[model samples]
Target chain A: MVTETSLSPIATFHSARRGRYEVAHQGVLALGEGTIVVEPGHNFEQGLQGLKGFDRLWLVYLFHLNQTEDAPPVMVKPPRFEHKVGVFATRSPHRPNPIGITPARLLHVAGRMLTVAQADLLDQTPIVDIKPYLPFCDAFPEAAVGWGGLAPTPYRLLWSEGARERVAEIASAHDLRLDHYAEVQLQLDPTDTSRKRIRATEQGFALDFREWSLHYEVRGEAQEVWIEQVTERPEFPGPSSLK
Target chain B: MVTETSLSPIATFHSARRGRYEVAHQGVLALGEGTIVVEPGHNFEQGLQGLKGFDRLWLVYLFHLNQTEDAPPVMVKPPRFEHKVGVFATRSPHRPNPIGITPARLLHVAGRMLTVAQADLLDQTPIVDIKPYLPFCDAFPEAAVGWGGLAPTPYRLLWSEGARERVAEIASAHDLRLDHYAEVQLQLDPTDTSRKRIRATEQGFALDFREWSLHYEVRGEAQEVWIEQVTERPEFPGPSSLK
Candidate 1:
């Protein structure tokens, strides 16, 4: 009995996670930090008075990057799932209403700006609402996760000295988060070549980036993915190399 | 920099709690059942697949009853708090976006219809989205609840035989839910006469409900409110009497 509703952004999120590939699917796995700056001229400062006391907050934000003009697909392939699940069953950005809710660990609240960690939002994302996370009402530790529980457990990421140095150099030179991207893609189902640009190498596995490649070995027993080396493709010269 | 965004409803919620006074502030305390009937012709049936496995779900719905056309007030007085806190600090329905998210216990899902319990939504409320509640991503048991933690504990309600019979008679005759309304209002702070239309009687406390009155006595030490009687106002003639 209700018509379409209109909403306006109250704040902007500033984060280093620039692209979808750089951010994790789950906010809890997103290691990056972000700041939410509430717009001035409103009484938002007064509204934010008691929010600092809470250790965590629920941020309701818009999925600004969803460019689909038609109705969202009925089914979606979650990166963690091998099969296509219903769009309602998965936390896909493409939905009837392009809205997202993530619980971020509240780090600091200074006036109209709030800093939060483990946020999966992209840079300049619009935030619509912020509510303190009440454990008594929000937390349901015993609830069954259903199909989500069947997803493969995340593999602990490890970097060798050589790989770490190479990744750092590439990150500083190109402002690309290769290491973060690798973790986001490889942490779960590191050997799923069907979903990721991965292939079997003589040593172990090699995941291909734009112009660079990451060589990693999966220690299945220990649940770890060790990155042994990082190298640029011989045929493709990158911007950093040309510079 | 994004402009105003528009959203359409994907489903309609049917619940017995019709009015604002009948619904609890927290969905976990609503103690009522509701069904979400997803709209047809949108392939919503396929979108509902695999959702039945989840024991709980997060429902994102619009606050349709919010009639204010202007920007929402920055500060709102929570029923549990004496002082007005930031609107974002509490789960107030009056918000800039007017969107609400509540975690509900999933009971059943058949085709495009899903049954849930403890939903704090009004009848025929428009639902925007539904996502499975993943405990790992949602649960924060130790998160400090800030001002919410300081709210007084709920008082268990006890009804006498006579009061129960009277309430049942009124409920069947007038289709009124007096028992549910009492629980929604009295469970938190029954003695607070400022917010509720309550007055002190010679025997105990009386809560006004239209032409009907509920007489109850608060046992502070036991944290219980005992309903002694349910009576119609002497001046107000009831439809049951006329029948």
Candidate 2:
């Protein structure tokens, strides 16, 4: 035997999507595209407006992707670890209670189409709760860098054939600049490797765009692109990656 | 006017110490040193034990300190941030929900006497719920490091008097390590600045204590000290510096 450990339940997450939200068991919240609505409601108007001003908000979503009938994993291979570290050290999707949170940006709030900046969730990823980023309260200035240092640093982006068009379209619609390195830094690579080496390689921008970071590799003049998908599973190819 | 933008809620914490625990609103909880035991039924026992194995556990406790008819702060100066930053940025004890979650470690669980590490809570700090660390799911390996870098680094204590003796006696009786830097990290400066600086100096050593890092630090030159009281806030007779 590998001498595995057992896990127990702690809490349940109540979640839902744009129009649907349910807290299933402890720490299990279900959310999807329909969870958030642009229309202002009595209990939600203030929160919605507060959410619009920021580029990104923290989604304290439940990790439904990791929920199981039996005990879930205590450790996971966090995307930042590139499948090399223990579960506890990484932010792998599989875990007990499966509660997950991500700082996603607000793209637009048109009536009911509450567009968001690059989110890793599917068309209907269940969202548990949303909190605005109070830059003062949320960001830890001197926090120590752990294995995340292994993630690619100095973020750079080399869009695929059609990815640039999509990004540009999204940027224009939102009146936000999405092409600069600083903009790209918003989505950090879990691996602290250099983007110049990977995107500049001959393979034409080998980039990895997950729900969080956008990693790229360049060869010769062509950029080898590997956009890390933002789903719970790192092995799963993203919609953009398929192209 | 500075032409400042009011983006999020602001709050202020009185002190980081033990007081009393009580239930307030429907979802709100209060933490105090006086009210230690809450009839968490026998069913919670299994769940509580599951939480003890982790290096850090999230305590979803109520902010009993802020009990009033007035609304809670829209922003807060997190104890770790000192008072320099806005309430939104720091994890101050005050908040709109009046809810607090401290990442603490489990030393041992003899019945209900849970000896925890990194418990910035006061003696008899009321614990509403305890959830173990599912490293795979909880750690945000790539999250940004904001003001944490600017905060002061914690200093090591070379005990001058019988502080070491007091710590030893308390630890032996309670099966606790009172003198470890982690304990001081939570107590010395219940203010966010002190916590931030201390965490910075030691690279969040308090966070490391739960994951076998405490054992390593205890083995080092730093001597352990016992806590004399968990109810009163220690006086720091200096001008309150903004973190």
Candidate 3:
């Protein structure tokens, strides 16, 4: 009789730079085009003996970024949807086991380092295992994607040199997305309650960051937010209490 | 920084009986239709929160049958093929990590008990985690299946009353599939050199399976084996030295 056993990750992934999106984009990129390096990997040597023939591999890894008991409540609010959805239904990061699996295109496998066409992992995602994708067994093209079609509306992000520097500085402190932080936020709710920066203008709307203000025209018909200008927010005096 | 961590299976699968096949059949049954009971399953309560919306789920379970590190030699001889294939190529039980992920049809989620339409796990198999099958993102119908099209030749398996009882008794000890074990062995090489069971016969071949002698005729052109009778092997006198 087979008994219970424990498992430890055999390897960890290292990448050149971290991306803005935490999870892999469904419709666009199944796996990102990033070359990841794994180390002290036992699966490298004998485990991948016959993997050279296949062009794709299944990356079985742990969600190391979400390895914690402190998760949001069961009903998680997906970014695209209006109401909160159940945890199991939506592919939310806050899971009980925090295990993540993705299919990556195999570019090259040199020793321990596996260069893949795409990867949806953090800089140092712990890989539990890797298996060659048996296509005949795992193909289901006609399968339905439940609650998975809501793509966030496209919003062009514009930044001034000064605005870029300020956004990067503020984002670094909180370790937030440099590319998508402002862009995604504005697309969802351009009224800009975040940091209390949005203002109604004659043209459209203006969102004021620390020292920068982003001017954008909301095209309701097209469902697009076109950022026109990024200007510096003027300095104001202290509160009236000081007077 | 997210460091290395360990993981233990939360739930264990309990079934009324174990089946013949180890890995999920590709062209045949992707996963067996059975209602499994998972208990005190760490992720049961929270993990299955929104599973009712979808009809299918991806069961990330451990290959509990292959828990021991003391596995057979790396060059595993697959049943269908004559030559030895790499351990990584075939979906054999003897794997480096022994983690099997299968897509199962969710029947009903009553509290903790998730009745699934399909499951390939053995009885008392340890479940590592579960993930919902996001079809849109994971669809790849045109993917090639490398070294995946070897079908076992069809053979007729017949058993007498005594042979049936003996085969069941032996299979019970090892907790294996009696029908599959017999059918697969015969399909691959009816000469029965697999378990060292083949003996020369005037008609065709005689397979000595423990105390049972399975008499069969191999039609080479038809690629079929027809078993005539199953009889108990005669006990000979001890060697001269032992006497």
Candidate 4:
């Protein structure tokens, strides 16, 4: 039998929020609120000294939220697909080894903090190691995509003036990134019900983000997400201004 | 303090050899011995079905050799530079979390055995997780490099007939991958003393790997690794045919 190694996190992440991250953004936004701040522990901050010179890095982290004291499941039902595939075949968090790896852009370094872009990890995730992204070694653009091939049909995000006003009110009260939410949920493919935050509506589709639900209509060919209505759940009271 | 998740290796690696990996081939050979077999444990093998459609993968593994029962170093002395840098700045294995991440090609898959290519890992390494390499998300060719920006100068590996024959014999007896050794040691920039397997010799330089010493001369521009001498230590017996 092989002996395994015990390890601890060298750093922790501070991000927008953490939970079941259903959006497989593919590390697309490597900047802004989407940016992940990697804070090196105590003496480990020096490791960030010369990292600013590199444009990219590999985030080796633990799948903290997915950890359980059981033999990981071999089969997984991916977001877009209905049939079960091997855990190795999919990037599902449920696995034999709860390790997460993502490629991120290193925006800048400040003291012990590193502002990075395009991270697929949850907030406060434990980092295992950081390696510079070597282009000649890591990139393979022409390679064929496995079962995850098709590009979601492009859909324009159309928000009415009233929809925008309502979202702004919700945003101010909740400190939610409603603009980013609109882009992430409505822009990618609003008509694709398989995506997170998207659901069928009487006239079109409804997008969900935390306490807010956005009602939108899919125009002809599902090419546009025409946001028609915006509302918050009564359970969570809105600002007195909204009342 | 934040709580960390405990992880276990899902599959074990079976490669040419194991132990201290003194070479970093950069997955340049992503085609041969560069190929690695990934055997999913128990029912996990079923997870790999239909993965061949993808061209690349991410290998998350444990740095077993660098593990210890003590605090990890925050400062690291990398192979290319002598100065101590932040543990996060360098890809040194002596990290707080001894984890290794490598991007590789998916050449083919047969049953439970997957022939993955271009990994910079040691034999029998414990793989924690495997993810498909999604090109649109992972590759960043134009990304800037920090202290590791400069690419090593190219060098040609020239071996005399006798040297080749001698290596063939030694390789046969000791089960060494001589071609891999020559390619890694020769193809990389020879002038950079920061690389592994290099030492100053009386005339030029000596490249060391495992139990053998290769004497080579670098030309005026340090552009060639002319292997003129090949000898094994008397302690390590050679094939009788060599006599």
Model 2: how far is B104 from its true place, Å? 1.6
Tens digits of per-residue lDDT for model 1, B1-243:
886788889999998877777888888777879999999999998998879789899999999988465877888888857888899898999987889999999999998899999898989899988999998888989888777654357788999999999989988998888888898888888888776567888988888777899999999989999999998787665444321
lDDT of 2 by residue, A1-243 (tens): 011111111112122211111121111111122224422232233333333455545554444444443544433434333444433333445533344455554556543335554344433344434554433323433333344422233233345555566555645674333343222332344133453312332332333332223334433233222442211235645555411
Q: Please state the i-RMS of candidate 4.
A: 2.1
- Better TM-score candidate (2, 4): 4
**Best by the TM-score measure:** 1
Error of 3 at B204 (Å): 7.9
> What are the models' TM-scores?
0.92, 0.37, 0.69, 0.82
- In terms of lDDT, which candidate is stronger, 3 or 4? 4
Model-by-model DockQ, in order: 0.70, 0.04, 0.31, 0.55
lDDT of 3 by residue, A32-83 (tens): 3555444453434555556566766777777765666754455676655566
The window of 10 residues in a row where model 4 chain A has the poorest summed lDDT is A234-243
Higher-lDDT candidate of 1 and 2? 1
Considering TM-score, where higher is better, how would the candidates rank from best to worst?
Answer: 1, 4, 3, 2
User: Which runs in model 1 stand beyond 4 Å of their true positions?
Assistant: A150-152, A235-243, B150-152, B172-175, B234-243
- Rank candidates by DockQ, best first: 1, 4, 3, 2
The C-alpha local distance difference test score for the whole of candidate 2 amounts to 0.36
Candidate 3: CAPRI quality band = acceptable
lDDT of 1 by residue, A1-243 (tens): 887888888899998878778778878877868999998888787788889789899999899988455787989987666788899998998887899999999999898899999888999899988888988889988888877644346788999999999999988998988888898888888987765478899999998887899999999999999999998788664554321
